[model samples]
Target chain A: MDKLLLLGDEALAQGALDAGLSGAYGYPGTPSTEIFEYVQHSKEAARRNVHRTWSANEKTAMEEALGMSYTGKRALVTMKHVGLNVAADPFMNSGITGANGGLIVAVADDPSMHSSQNEQDSRHYGRFALVPVFEPSNQQEAYNMTFDAFALSEKYKTPVIMRLVTRLSHSRAGIVRTKYLNENEIKLPDNPNQFMLLPAFARVKYKNLIEKQELLEKESENSKYNEYHDGKDRSLGIITCGLGYNYVKENHVESKCEYPILKICQYPLPRKLIQKIIDECDEILVVEDGMPVIEEWLRGYLDNCLKIKGRMDGTLPRCGELDPAKLRTALGLEPYPIKEVPTIVKGRPPELCKGCPHRDTYYALNEAMKEYGPGHVFSDIGCYTLGFLPPFNAINSCVDMGASISMAVGAADAGLFPSIAVIGDSTFGHSGMTPLLDAVNSKANIVAFILDNGIVAMTGMQDSAVTGRVEDICMGIGVEKEHIHVINPLKGHHEENVKIIKNEINYNGVSVIIPRRPCIHIAAKLRKQK
Target chain B: MKKNIILAGVGGQGILSIATIIGYAVVKVDIYLKQAEAHGMSQRGGAVESHLRISDKEIHSDLVPHGRSDMIISLEPMESLRYFPYLKPDGWLITNITPFVNIPNYPEMKHLLKEIKAHKNSIAIDGDAIAKEIGSPRSMNMVILGASAPFLGIPFNMLEDSIRAVFGRKGEDIVQKNLDALNRGRDFAEEYIKK
Candidate 1:
């Protein structure tokens, strides 16, 4: 096959294809969303009828992947790091239950809270699941590992996690070509006892899981994934994992006469590899992305005697992703001469696209809230959350999906005047409606802004649950027909919409604002059709 | 031979597209390849980074460590600087001179330009200008990608094929525009060397 350009997510999808995966399951989330989207959209996948769909959420996605693997098919499940929290229950159990087929779960972690609620590392989840985790530093690894992970999963009869961070999930890289169209064998579980979780069965499985730890450790020992290069000089050794290694190697700042490197990609911590590198060098600098799991592990295993240094010891900061310059400084190399940068361009701070329905909705909201004296809006995660930024600044808080309506109700219960919740069509379906029902039943004086962009725009516009049933769902939730205000967001109806909103704000009960508009991105995309 | 290349940029900058095209081009050359990218928060105006590893032999790991990359290609200047630590001492940096201001701190950006100019082994091109000259500023990504192609061992024709594959039916106009931008970038680099 010829080389093809692939998104980090698409490359992972291709990697899964190369890895002989039979299926993939996931819900859309930025950074991690594209993998499933690609799997769903790829011509090769479609022709082969590979089982790819956006599962309702991460939990279902994981279980479905598990189901496919239970039938002895290779499966890949992916989600953003936070989505793993939603699927953590099954993820933990999959280890104890074991796998009948090859299973790879790719979780893309977001550090620095880019499009996520928190910068949490998903590797911790893999550690918790007691499964081997593979973190690829670049696109080629992303592809190769997706394929390699399946084999490892089936060989070990345990699900493997391929963890990626934002940098590694979305970045592009040059990768050499190999054969394609590989698909895994489909097999069925011979013993129902393997998946059954009754105490008798689960207890035995748990013990097996415990015993598998040693097997996993042993696998890590001779595993080709755990490798080291014997530097001619072994004074100051570098041990790096994932993209952090790329950052280190890019500078070639490794000490010529001092540093040997132990590059760890497979986990359960390859203790032998770490020990060998540590013993060969006077000082060990551990570089890994996100948290210092490796550093902390090395510190504990070496009893802090190895002069092990990394993020935990203030040699590196506890937060933010790292770059090569920082690694150079850590390696005691001269800094690259700083280049004269042109003045950074100050472009428009991103907001909802102009003429977007959310913009009109917020305009009406800001107008109606003049009497309320501001600080009344609660928002949820969507493109509309850009309402919190200036020009709009209409939203007060946006913590997570489905948080807006409930947060608004809480504010109203706490005696805040004219409380308003701004949520999108998809978020309302994800978790927003129950709070609206709660507010209606409790007679809370809150207005919920249901900005219907007709899709889940924040995560690349996957289908929204309420796309067709918004009205019935709202009505069923007890929102009064009279108070359900529907208005086009881009139309010049802010004054009338403001009047309706003010009327609802004074209603002393729950009100629903259905600001309907197409997302500009989606709209433009659709318009190109005409 | 093992080569590590890093690509860095802000979200929505088309850096990933450039990287993907390059990844495809490299594979067309029949080398063992491992690559990964960072996204997620990137869609929210955050920085994005990607790592590319090309080898002649089978690869066990997908990641490349610090100080080992042969080159750094940045679609934006500050983003390139952000990944500066990854570049080898003799490594090449290919970046567009286009600027993005309002990073979290360093309110006075005029002074930041001085810092960028002081860097060594940096090849900065007015990719935005080239894109505008060829067509859209969005094509700046392709221009910067074109500037780095020769040094990265990717042929322009291979990249064009990848572009066509990705863009599908839209490949005709997009490929032509991007090709123009790329040629302009290559010409600029050639002219800079002469100077």
Candidate 2:
């Protein structure tokens, strides 16, 4: 067996490759981004001509992967937790349609909101969609489970969700790879209507999905990733889920553990093993990252007599990633005496780079909107989202991807004059086009600033889907041609850029201003490569 | 034996490169190592730290537990102090003396230096100056790595070999320059500790 030092995300990529992955689709995001990156950079993937590229957004990625699966090929889709929300449409529907070949959805969740707006657990989505979910506890498991997930997917005719937390996705460890499987030949589904979802067909598919739940649970109970260990200490039974298992092992590695432990890395509750733990011990501690989905089920659904302690109670902090220190306090041990950071150590929040084009754009936008005051600009996710911070308190709202354009339209309809929207080029391609059409249809009086950095810019400069086509897309969406203006965002052109923005703000109809420049990081990368 | 180390710096400060060299060294020695890195959004000129753990046995967690770290190797002075809770009372803090003042209200240099000196075992070396003196300004991270190598439980020569292995692809010039920077940093630390 050959060993490779790989990040958890990279391990998953290798697992997919070894599992005969035919296509890999994903939009760039933290933690999950490297999975696709590894695939794209692999010589093996290149030799195989595997379909690995960035999608416009997670929804497109999801559907594209489903398309590949329909062709009787194994496909993997990667995204962050919030990206799951964007892909939820096709994702939820895919449960009923079922997978033809193997389909694996790998979502990296941020339990502490490390680089995300929210720390959502995608495990709930797995349950909601009636799909089997696999949670790997460590790097090697991430590899093994992903390779196994494909086989599991085809066995059940369902898309398998592989849930990963930030820590698991970002950490590096040596992994021993398994034997490579052959890619599936082009063979369509035996039944022509397997993917057809007309109301009549959908109803039967839905029922089939409903009937599979019991089997999924049984599979979970028998999963290799889930194990039950008996200890002499019957007073307490510890149940750890996903990455939380590591912290418990961290605490126990030094000494012999007295409490019985049930480690769960697969979904569907594994009630058989859980029940055994409950019957043997006095109380059960449900350790999990993100939301207390399992804990809530134990208390609300089972309503067992024994005490179930977890995030719902104060036993563990309600939020954030769990570490060994937190586990120490939970197990009735005193916290380690640690030196606090001195007063001289000031807070160092993440900031925009010194030469970021968004800086020039913000400076000009702030000057142009001096009369309109604050609370007028709505921004989308990107490096530009930092506009909410000080020195340039430019943007007011940042709810979701492509929310800026529609939000600004809504504000304009509410009689707020000079309603403005700031979005990035990549984001505009993702979900902004539809909202721009909505504004164009209604002729809303607003100024939309498209910050075109010629790259995705935020997630390590992935190629933007809307490269050299921002204005063309806006025009194609029915935004007036004359009202669309492109300005180069630079300190030297700040005054003219401000003038252009002010002119657009005064326009009664929907207007778009693009501040175009290469991202600093992208420019440097290009220079270095040259 | 187990060793927990926190590698701290700004996002673009080549902190992960230090982790890479050490990782390569440990892998060759057939020891287990786990490095948890910060990526994506934080890389836009924000503070970042990589938790590097090396041991003979398995490492369970990606994070270094608070007050259990054996060393904090940092590229910036203030960034060095950011992980105080993670460092043991007697742990070493080897960091560059320069400041990366990306924030608006960075602390005064004197106060920052005073806080560094308050630590039980600390080395505030001029990594930037030594790198420049070695004629490789970009090798400042290598210098910081060299300064911390004495306390890393890894052999100095192993780290020197790692520098060559990690930088070999760039060119022989880069390898030699980085090697020079590492030795200079070690020389500085050997002299500074005599006091």
- Which residue pairs clash in candidate 2? none
The weakest ten consecutive residues by lDDT in model 1 chain B span B102-111
For all predictions in the order shown, the interface RMSD in Å is: 5.9, 1.0
Chain A TM-score, structure 2: 0.98
DockQ of each: 0.23, 0.81
- Backbone clash count for every predicted candidate, in the order shown: 79, 0
lDDT, candidate 1, at A172: 49
- Per-residue error for A48 in candidate 2, Å, reads 0.4
* DockQ of prediction 1: 0.23
Across residues A1-530, which tens digit of lDDT does each residue of candidate 1 receive? Answer: 55565656677888787666788888788779888888888787888889886676788889999999999888889888888887889999998898988988889887666677788887787778898998887776678777667777888789998888876676544554575646756567878678898999999889988888888888788777677877876667889888777767755633333458788888888878887887788888888888888777668754648488888777777777776667767777776554232445333344454456777787778888877677888898778777888777787787877889999888899999888888888878877878888998899998887888888877767887678678789899898888887877655676788788888888988888788877876887768888
Mark the 10 consecutive residues where model 1 chain A has the least summed lDDT: A339-348
- What lDDT tens digits, residue by residue, belong to model 2 across residues A158-255? 99999999998999988889789989998898889999999999999999999999998999999889999889999999998888888888887768
| Candidate 2 lDDT over residue span B1-195, tens digit each | 789999999989899999999988887777888999999888877889999999999899989999999999999999999999999999999999989898878999999899999997999999998888878999999999888877888988899898888999999999999999888888878888887
Q: State how far residue A323 of model 2 sits from its true place (Å).
A: 0.8
Compared with the true structure, the alpha-carbon lDDT of candidate 2 equals 0.91
Estimate the TM-score of every prediction.
0.82, 0.98
